[model samples]
Target chain A: MRGRARDGDEQRFLDITGEIGPELLRYFQRRIGSDAPDLVAEVMVTVWRKRALLPLEHEHARMWCFGIARNLLRNYSRGEQRRSELSRALRATVSVTDVELDSEEAVAIRDLIYQLGPDLAEVVTLTHWEGFSLAEIARLQGVPAATVRGRYRRARLALLAALSTDVAPTLL
Target chain B: MTQDKDHPAGTDRELGALLARGARPTTEATTEVRDQLAEMAAAIVSTNQARSRRRAGLISVIVAPILVLGVAGTAYAVTNIDWSQLWHNTPEWAEWAQDPDATVHYALPGGGTCELRLGEVVYSPDPNRPADVAADPRAEQAARDFLRTADLLTVADVDAMITAMRDKDENWAQADDGTAVPFGYGTDNYNADVEYNMAVKQAIQVAVTDHVESMGIPSTGLGFQSQEQCTGADQ
Candidate 1:
């Protein structure tokens, strides 16, 4: 009986990891860049440990994993900034640019998105980049679907306004 | 470099396309990374299962003697033995023996084991007097000492202890809704885990309220409490 149970868990785990593992890598990469793989590995182990809590529906499961990835990214960002500051003081000047992880185009657009503030940028990123609908983003972000919709609308208008200015030529 | 398929027409389409191109992952998780992730997860799950089994075995080793001693103590209780002489000869302070309620035995995070018996009035041993002569009432001090050593305990440690306890229960499958139980079982285990977690947490709260209130030391109320008299080579 235990043998069959173990087999079932192994299969469930495989199904979950196969579905979300790559997407989580992409999710973290968009936010954290070079540290993404290690964080993806951390998220995988967390997903495995918390497999029972995973939503049965595929889309909802993706949202659940995204929620975990977002939380981890927040913690990493907070701690990483402090650590990097301390390290910078002690170490010699080094570039530390991760060419493989951060593309020039992505970084440029990311800077532009950040101009919209965190809530707006989050709605835009989740909607456009991660391919979550407003309703799904609401569930992940713990807000109403209408709220997410409003943020996305505001973001679009803001980005368009920016684009119509001096930056329009470069973006186009 | 990215396909523009998601957004509707006009400026929305252009903005969405740009965002998609910009925020897209620079590197996808390759086949090798995925395989390595699976292997790492498998190893973690397997190690936890093995540890659970070891803990289950350890519980039996701990519980079997307690069960035998319970029976022996019951017989001794009824026999009307010499109270003073027996108390003197016992050599060790066994509060759980005297007052059995609210005792929890758990492993320390670093190493060794602790048995905590709460709300029991402890008496300083007197060879000339009867066992029930007087209650020294040092349970607060014992609880305080317990808190000192248990500073390292965390919620994860508590959950791990609960998992260990659950693993030892042969009737756990039948105890919950009858389904083929996995190592990490579904909703039933989750509910049980939450309930057990709450009970242990409440036990700590009760211990704090009972003992720490008088010390006037505001209880930060972290981790489990233990009896210093209960631990060590004397046990």
Candidate 2:
């Protein structure tokens, strides 16, 4: 939002986690709604541990990640539900947006963003599609504050051009 | 699409920032998750290393007696140790092989070699005599023990045994009853090879128990395979 912030050295996380994190977040969110944060934490821990399993290609990695998440979903369901308050306490630890994006739009945005090369695509998609704060993306991507901005600028312009419509300044 | 994350009032900027956030688990979470997975991987490696070390240790233990005896510098001193009594007291292969008739040899791949011939072959000759015996694990094992037994023999004796092993005859002769047999398995120059092969068999015999166990044989089943699937390749 602050005009394309640069997140430097996200190569490792970018190369691994990519956009899979949020998709996993959403997956855990829906399968076990309000308990989403704990599930998200659990899913991420899984991603990190099995990070080697992720494909080097970010797109393919995301798909493979979700496939794992789907399995985790089964695991979560079969599990005896933890105390509601305990999960509530865990969810409260993080300030995540409750706003749900339309899956169809999320997919469209993801596809548009994916069109960019890895770096620009990652920043653009994570910021716009996955809904991470620049601070968070900067942290995860391991980039200094400025690089994220440059990537975002190039990403926004490219995204705008790809969408081909200035009518809704943001979707691009 | 409906809410328009990109807004003229700088909505797309805010939208982009939100999209990039992924869940970063805490350190405890990271450790907890990776611990189990890494532990599983480590366990597999450790198990293999342990088995290898165990076999190595067994071999060292088996060879200890031989080295002790060799260093004692007197064959008679070795013969004097009521080996049967020692074997009964120790209740281990080392004592059992101390018998004058029992042959002991060190082999590679671990499980120090011990060939306890019950004075004679327990099972009848494979009918075809030694050739029909087909050099199974047992035969290979016996070959090793024979090496040690042959150790008690003079150079001339080893030469004779090596000829028999090769199925040829340098000093080939008929028994008093004129039983002219082809003997080429034992020769003096072949001692090194015999030593090496015996070491290999010792290792194979010890390390291959796992493979042999799964082969549906009790693994202790008498008689060696022509080519043991475990440590041996097609000979």
Candidate 3:
């Protein structure tokens, strides 16, 4: 597997890099914006060379890569420069998972949603919205299947309750 | 309550549909990003391949000089170099033979080697050490020292020193005393050969060390080969 990655062939580079590149760029776009195009480009280069390190399936690898990207972008956004850009090309591409809210009242339920802690937010993003299976989301977030269920239930209930109360009306 | 062929709970029916709708990717967006990805992927492959080719080409070109010098070195041994014939017939031949930087080709019994070298020693007249080798003990000593230090890079100690010289994070091209020390001494053919060898040795050592380290292991006992070899200027 590692040998193929080192082979410097054009087809192999594209086969792995071609599909995930867009999902990753959008992943970055929703998280940061603007200068993210360049950062995403840099990460893709790293991914091309390191793709052999990935698991067999594309979607799993895509989620795994986004996990790594989240870490890197967080590091990049910390200080050196304020990453601010609504550049047309990047703004044109948004991760609907990040932008779409359930209901207007659902949006204001951040207090309740976050009440389960950041872990709840992660589970929702990975499982409910990102469409990853319960097992995949639990594995990704490094939590057990049961805990993932408990949090998913609590989060949904919080959202529903917030909605009933006419909360911020945005938290899905 | 909820029920469907896919979901046992009806409550999740709305959630699943909404999540699917929310993250729906536009085909047009994926297409545009795919084109950009292909271009960048091609650029990376081109850059890496170009670098590998350049390195191989340089080593081949630089090694070509050794072939020429190896032949000339053998010819000088068997055939007499008549000064008169050399002066009139092949004037350029005299200059080349006399030039310290001439390409010297050597023929061993079965195998051959070559090297391109700088012109002969243009001596400075230090009154105490005249241009004539018989008069200049310092010049003679300098030549001797140059030969002594130019041992096989196979020497464990010498290889270690060369590694140290290269390991220094210095711009060897500059005069900075940062890490790599330049081997500077004289203008004799032997000195010229040794100095060039030192530089080549440093680069080779550095390359080997770097390549090895990149593989997550420390390197040991990997000796570098010199680009130059001795020819029969003695006889």
What's the count of clashing pairs in each model shown? 0, 57, 29
Which parts of model 1 are misplaced by more than 4 Å? A1-7, A78-98, A101-105, A165-169, B1-11, B57-235
Put down candidate 3 lDDT per residue, A1-172, tens digits, no spaces. Answer: 1344345345645676676667666555433444455556545544543444554566676666665555455445422322212122333443332344344333333345455567766566555444556566666667787676777777666655654664334323
User: Which pairs clash inside model 1?
Assistant: none
| Candidate 2 off by > 4 Å | A1-24, A27-107, A129-131, A165-172, B1-235
Q: State the TM-score of candidate 3 restricted to chain B.
A: 0.21
Please identify which of the two predictions, 1 or 2, would achieve the higher TM-score against the true structure: 1
List model 3 lDDT by residue over B1-235, tens digit each.
Answer: 1123112123475544433333323223456566766665665556446545644554333212111111111112112322121112221433434433223233322232234233332223324422221222233222222222321121112333333344452221212233322223321211233333344334333332332222222222222122344333221
**Cα lDDT of model 3 overall?**
0.41
- Give the CAPRI rating of model 1: incorrect
Q: Write the per-residue lDDT of candidate 2 for residues B1-235, one digit (tens) a residue.
A: 2233322124675444423332222222333333432332233234334545644554333211111111122111221222222112233433334343433233323333333222222222233332212213343334233233332211112222322334433323233444433222453222233233333333333323322221222222232321111222111
**Residue B208: error of model 1 in Å?**
23
Candidate closer to the true structure by lDDT (higher is better), 1 or 2: 1
Task: Provide the overall lDDT of each model, using Cα atoms, as 2-decimal numbers.
Answer: 0.49, 0.38, 0.41
Indicate which candidate wins on DockQ: 1
lDDT of each residue in B16-135, candidate 1, tens digit only: 778876764445455655565565455546644654564455433221111110111211222222222211234454654455334555543324344544434232333343332222
Worst 10 residues of 3 chain A by lDDT: A78-87
